[model samples]
Target: DAGVTQSPTHLIKTRGQQVTLRCSPKSGHDTVSWYQQALGQGPQFIFQYYEEEERQRGNFPDRFSGHQFPNYSSELNVNALLLGDSALYLCASTAGGKGHAPAKNIQYFGAGTRLSVL
Candidate 1:
């Protein structure tokens, strides 16, 4: 089965510009989450999408938004980007079922799209 995948592998942008990143969830999965990983910092959850709705979100500005399609793929859009936005944008997928089981609720991540804002 196919796993989560992200696009552009790498990206470069300037301050005040906008950027969009894409993601494909793992097979038989319906949940996708986006995360931001700075050079030396752990990944910080941006948001999670399930059934085309955001089910959970982390501490982030309004500049960060996302969408999930019926195909179970997702896209993250950032408006008025900042140099601080430079980081690795990771996409995670999980089979949303039986949430009571920790193993069944685990998330799988992709290599991520590296965004560099100058």
Candidate 2:
């Protein structure tokens, strides 16, 4: 019954350096999605992965990318980061074997990796 987990609960980076964040899905879950939440805005979907392949993507630029390993864990990589990139990065998981929720399935989020770009 483990829930999603993220590493480095918080992070700080310069405007152009890169950063990598990690996520482990909940028990028995097979899908992972990434989201970015600005200071006062709702979470914005970055992308989703299932079966290790990207299933869907949002409007983010190519600077954002990710990988899901065989163990259903994931990593989010942001390169040449910008000041605006500073925000909370969330990792959400859903069990593929279960039925999708009425509202496109609820995404259970980790506390999130808070990135601060200088």
Candidate 3:
């Protein structure tokens, strides 16, 4: 009955370092989305995954990547990190796929992982 969950609640890294953030979706949810939120700014969409495949992506550079597992868990990987990448990374899950109405795809979010790059 737990909602979406993310790990390593906080992290610190240097420029050019790589980081991986993890998330487990809520029960019965098969889709996941990743977002980055900077201070005083709204969350920016990164990408979405369904059926273990990336279904959509935002304007982020190739340094951002992700994967969805069979169990609906997901991992967001960022490579060659930059100072601008410092932010709160959020994970959201919702029931998705065919036959589900767009309105029903109400996303449930996790507490998020805060990453800081120096």
Q: State the TM-score for model 1.
A: 0.95
- How far residue 75's Cα lies from its native spot in candidate 3, in Å, is 0.4
Q: Assess candidate 3 and give its lDDT.
A: 0.95
Residue 114, model 3: Cα distance from true site in angstroms: 0.4
Error of 1 at 54 (Å): 0.8
Rate residue 28 of model 1 by lDDT.
82
In TM-score terms, candidate 2 sits at 0.93
* Model 3, residue pairs in steric clash: none
Which candidate leads the pack in lDDT?
A: 3
Query: Per-residue CA lDDT of candidate 1, range 7-113, in tens?
Result: 98999999999999999988888899999999999999999999999999999999999999999899999999999999999999998753556766899999999
Candidates by TM-score, descending order: 3, 1, 2
Query: What C-alpha lDDT values do all the predictions have?
Result: 0.93, 0.92, 0.95
TM-score versus the correct structure, for each prediction: 0.95, 0.93, 0.96
Which 10 successive residues of model 3 have the least lDDT summed?
96-105
Model 2: weakest 10-residue lDDT segment is: 96-105
